[model samples]
Target: MSADRRRILRTTAQLAALTAAGPLLAACGQEAATAGGTAAAAGSGPPHPHASPGTPTVLTPNRIPSATPSSTPGGSASGSPPALPPLAASTPPEVVTGPRDRPQIALTFHGQGDPKLATALLEAAEQHGAQVTVLVVGSWLDQQPQMARRILDGGHELGNHTLSHLDISSMSGDQAYAEIAGCADRLRTLTGSIGRWFRPSAAQYATAEVKAQARRAGYEHCLSYDLDPRDYADPGAEVVQRRILGGIKPGSIVALHMGHQGTVDALPAVLEALQQRGLRAVTASQLCS
Candidate 1:
């Protein structure tokens, strides 16, 4: 063949080769992306003190097919936690617990106190492949705005615990409404929507009127626990663990608190005990579902 013809033939062959490899290269790129996404989703830190404090990736229910969509409002994505959707219908505005038929429990935290201790407890649960719920005081969220996102990012749930962590049950209706609504507004601004669950401050159970106010504020249910280890008293970790383990049963909701070193110390053992008993520690949403 003439030199010009040969050069043209070589160029044509190169073009064909490039065209054929394009799909394979594209496929490779896609695979890599998928793998990374999965790791980011699953590897959202050990929920320990060492977890990435800067916020981790958010995975929608679609990313986790086994996960039912948030029974309440708000979801998350990308950098900041994204509220999933507006509340279609109010969640049942009644007291609830995980069903007794299941061998699962919810380890719920009162969201306040030391950020580091809270982080430690969360990390311990995550290390054991458990997910817990944190009902945060609005004021606490204000001091640690990143914590709202951090809680959700750790494959956990974050909800309202009143704005000032005051005695909502004792307040007048209008006063109670402000406390609920105010905290809710903080959650909305930080994480896209007011979280699903609300727990009254200074009281384990909500009064009839407080429930009404919470419903008005948009929470479907006010959370209550079946067990209290009294970790809030800063009781030693052993006592906290004993109290919880003693009362733990299928579908039990254990009221725990953040910012206590004892609770943090007790959590890992409690998780282990649950695991050995063939019980799983999960978020309240997961437990209820």
Candidate 2:
């Protein structure tokens, strides 16, 4: 071959070698990406489907500050969604109650079923000048995207209740993480933060793996209830009222169901009773903070 032709052949050979090494370099990059991460340390899994672009940034569990209370009913004057407060760290990331020194309690509702019933509950609580927490089910929020804003607009705090309300304790680490993150993504998309708290589904307390997954999903607290009135069983409204009244104490976190009309019926009396006993109702974040 002529000198110029020989040089051209050599350059083409070098180009082929570089092209063959491209995938190898890419593989090294991926390994570097995974090697130092906690999720990779556990075990790699498929990316979460609900994981979407531009999801609000997650707050660090230990460093996130509590949100200032908003005075407006619907949204800020700028019409932006309110930011969620960071949960105070619980070593186990689970809380059954708040400080007993203050005569205040948190009434939290599981968001499910009828949106109208949930609306009624909010309206009723507003009438009593109470602000409670609503731990939203991911699928439920999917059904009613506006409800997330509605909950915040009503001045109630919001928290995660998993993606499908599955029994997260039974899920694998990856599965559990997906459940937590999936719901968190929805919350973050709706509001500017991942809300303040997380609660496990079909159970009161989070398992060890579930707690780790919740931390990964950016929750600092896993809220468990101190008082459950069993209104989900469709027990009579009076019975629900009696159970709530009987069990309530200072700093109690009471769990109720938004799906049940019985809870709707019981709430007016429940609020009246709390007031009569000189106990004020506040959001779970406020109660804990």
Tell me, by TM-score, which candidate is best: 2
lDDT of 2 by residue, 201-222 (tens): 7788888898899999898779
Estimated TM-score for each candidate? 0.70, 0.73
Q: Which residue pairs in candidate 1 have backbone atoms (N, alpha carbon, C) closer than 3 angstroms, thus clashing? A: 47-122, 47-123, 48-123, 74-84, 75-82, 75-83, 75-84, 76-82
- Provide backbone clash counts, one per model: 8, 0
Error of 2 at 8 (Å): 52
Q: What is the lDDT of candidate 1?
A: 0.75
The C-alpha stretches of model 2 lying farther than 4 A from their native spots are 1-74, 77-79, 83-92
lDDT of each: 0.75, 0.78
TM-score for candidate 2: 0.73
In candidate 1, what are the lDDT values of residues 1-289, reduced to their tens digit?
8999999999999999999999999999999999988976664422321122222122222332122223222334443553433332433555456778888988888887777888788778888999898988775665566677777877888888876666666688888888788778777777767888999877878999989999999987888988887887877999999999998999888888888899999989998999999999888777755
